[model samples]
Target: MKVVKIGGSVFKKENIINLAEFIVKNYEPYKTIIVVSALGRSPYPYSTDELINLFVEFKQNHSNGNNYLLDLSKSFVVSCGENIAAGLLSFAINYLNPEFKAIPLNAFQANIITTDNPIDSDIITIEIDNILRLLENKFTPVICGFQGVSKSGKLTILKRGGTDITAAFITKLMKANEIHIIKDVDGLKSAPPNIIPHCITIEKCNIDELAEATMNGNPVVNPEAINILQETNAKIIIKSIFSEKFTLSSKEIVPTQLVSNISNKDNITKFVIYLPSQMKNKTLVLDKVLKEIFENSISLDFINLDVFNNLASFIVNNNQVEKIKQILDNNQLHYKTMGRLSKVSIIGYNMRGKPGIMYRINKALLNEKISIIQAQDSHISISLLVPLKYLATTIKALHQEFFEDY
Candidate 1:
């Protein structure tokens, strides 16, 4: 059996018939399951983004102010996209060829159980019996991606862009041969093509390489999908529905680049939480400050909690720095901001257990006279916090150092 996940990029009324034709032509004789994302970003009524906007407009107009109800209704409202996509694709497939018994299935009907979180929920369990029955009856079961039902029957959507995880889970649970992730782009690239004029499309890479390239704030594939299939052996093929050119993601074939990809984002701001030595329970105060930050919906990254030094720091989107400042000032907390920062990131499986990777990164930036304000590294990636003015030069330097041949 094969699991094909059609992303929102190509899951639309304009392309549904063509995709249906392709599905019927290729997998007519096999027990195939399809996971579909909402329609691509358009003015279309049922795209998840549009539906989310609709929900926002409703909230703004009505002023319901009920967090629980708004959350529940928002999830229910957004999930309608996948529901429509599944049904439309299933019908198109059947309409294209009568022999293909394509049947649309919702999360609840397909027995996909998830947590109660309306906006971002985890899949708890999935019973394959219903899907098995449908396939045994020679029906092509098309499931709405990115959503499942809680035990209480509340419709729960996974994290934003979670349709990929839905497909990965299906591939693992059904023990399918492989996963075909159909997207608009041909395949993964060494760098954002627009940024790096000479970048090349990566032909094939290990799952880790693919994850690194995709996870660095790129919207190619949901990182959660890679995490779900960590133990899975299924070959992952990412291809554009419009062309046969693809990137084969396996466990063994790591990327050839020492640093596989360069990722950067603009308008990031650094924040520091100062814990005064005289303050009793400095740790507790830090915790309270962090709690208030989260409560105010201030998301952050690159958190450096220096308990010994009685200080804590992190980065947040620049737009949120004002709000963060207000929260800190209102709580009478001591903090400071390093605004107008940018993040430059690089990742490679080759860097695993290898020394001097940081030296190379530092040397590259140092040669270019770019000051790295702060830096962090894990087994797979190295991230740098640099001034926004040096962002372009930093990327050029890193690319020249790490990917000069390209």
Candidate 2:
């Protein structure tokens, strides 16, 4: 079995026909399922954002302005885009192969059950027997992504990039042999091709490396989707829909491993806010502080809260420091600042049980007389906070130690 997700960017009329032909030609032997996203950037009347905006305007102008009604209405309205795309693709497939059957299925029909968050719902249960029945009868099930039905039967939409999540969930549920995410780009690149000179395309990477890149603002794929893939045995192929000579082969994500030289040099500022150690209700204070910070449109990074010392430290961009300071001052919080710091991370999926990885990283940086202010590690990544002056050196030294051909 195979699950293929066609991205919104490549859901044009001609592209849909081409995709149908490609699947019929190559995947005839397998039970294939197609997932489609809304049409992208075309002069379409019902893009997701436009649908939401239209619903809000209509509600404000015509309805009683109830919040529940607004959310419910928005969910139903925005889902139309995916439904249209799915229906169109199913039609194209059936047209191309008259002997083959293609069926368009919405979330309700496919049994994608979720929580009632309306805008960004969490999938609770997905009944797959109906999908299996379709495949058994030699039908191609074209599913509308990014939309699902709540337990209470209310229409709910997943977060933006939810189609990727939908595909991953289905792939895991069905234990599909492979997943192909058709997108506009060639594949994941080492860096943004337009910004970084001579950036190379990454042909293979584990889920950890992909997640690290996604978290560091690389828009190759959805982080949530990658999280789902981490639990499955399926290998994902991220390829361009424009490519005619692409292979179905994929780079599998190995467990407890990491790949090196993945670095983000963006300047970030670290703030350590001190709370009164004797103060009760620390949770309340922390929540209020964080709420204010988020309201200012400032995103916190590398956050660490030490409840024992009542110290909360986090990093933010230089541009958000002044606003953060004003919020702290207004709340009468005492804090210390560390500016001009850069985050260097070595990411891999196999770094979890491995020994001496940190020791080697420390030795490389120490040899250069670079001071490491702070370090954070996950199962797949070890991130260091160093001075901006050592950013390039740190990346080069770590890359040489971990990724260089020896």
Candidate 3:
């Protein structure tokens, strides 16, 4: 079975029907399931301000010992559900192309149970499996994405950009052959086309390469989706639905090549602060001072503490220089923002296992006037944190030095 997840941006009333017809025509010999996110034709109409207002009202009602906020949240969630169902059904019946069975996705049968909190929900694989089996008798199921009802019968919603997660869960449970993630773009590219005009499409990329690219801010697909694919060993092809040409090629797109081809505006330079173990309890002082510095409005990512050794590391934006110093000075923490910090990642299954992998990576960076501040070795990736300013230079230099012919 092939499980296909369509993106919200590519969602069109006509496109949905068009896609259904195409899938039935091409893969009708095999079983296929479709999952759709609430984007495009039936977009969630609630504005940010309205969502916030509803959230606040819910909170106030809870504090005042009333169920009013709970009721409001449920109503709003149902409205979203209705829009999703209506759009999908309308697309199936009215907009679909000639010669295919067009069936409306009954909202009640789709009964996705979520958590009480509309903002969060968990995937009950059992429920999902039952739903899939129910569809086995007849009909290609179209599920409402990003929203579900919990076992307790409360409506819950998935996080933003969570349709991938839903699709992944379905794929893993079904043990499907491949996942076709149809979006607006042609496939995963060597780099953002606007930045590297010469960039070409990637015909083949292993789990390792996808992970490294996604972690480094590649725009093709979400990293979490890649991680899930790794665990399930399920193949995923990210392709553009609008493209007319359909040709499959066998080319191993090198990881280092892709890494060197890209540029990201949000490249983060992390600062890992190692403090004495005894100072862990005294974090109140650091916390107070850090709060004052944070108020200056610098964006912070992944502020986490190591329980074992009382270490804290936070990722900060590449451009926030003044704010970094302000936080350091006010806290009076003995620290140094290591100047030589960049991320050099290696992604390949065959490139796995040699005692000298780290040695080779470190030696290459060292020759390029780069220093490895911290190194993390995962199953298929070796990420080295190096100097921020020299990141691009070091990655390109390393690509040419070690992986040019790979």
Q: What is candidate 1's lDDT per residue for 1-406, written digit by digit as tens?
A: 8898898877778888898888887675338899999987757778888998998898899975678778988888999999889888888988888667888888988888898878789888788899998888878889998888898988889987778888888889998878888888777766666677776566777788777656566566788888877668888888886777788888877667677678777799888887777778777777787898889877778999997887889998878888888877877778888888988888777888888988989999999898899998878889899999988888888888887775
Q: Count the clashes in each prediction.
A: 0, 7, 12
Residue 44 in model 1: lDDT? 79
| Residues 100-173, model 3: lDDT tens digits | 23343432356655555556455564255545654565446666556566576655666655567767777887
Which pairs of residues collide in model 1? none
Colliding residue pairs in candidate 2:
256-349, 256-350, 257-348, 257-349, 257-350, 258-348, 258-350
**What TM-score would you give candidate 1 relative to the actual structure?**
0.87
In order of appearance, the predictions have TM-scores of 0.87, 0.75, 0.65
Runs of candidate 2 with Cα error greater than 4 angstroms are 42-44, 59-63, 244-270, 276-300, 305-311, 316-332, 336-379, 382-406
- The parts of candidate 1 lying over 4 Å away from their true place are 25-30, 63-72, 277-300, 307-310, 318-332, 366-369
CA lDDT of every candidate: 0.83, 0.78, 0.58
Error of 1 at 319 (Å): 6.3
Best by TM-score: 1
lDDT of 2 by residue, 269-331 (tens): 999989998888887988999999878768887889887878999999888889999999998
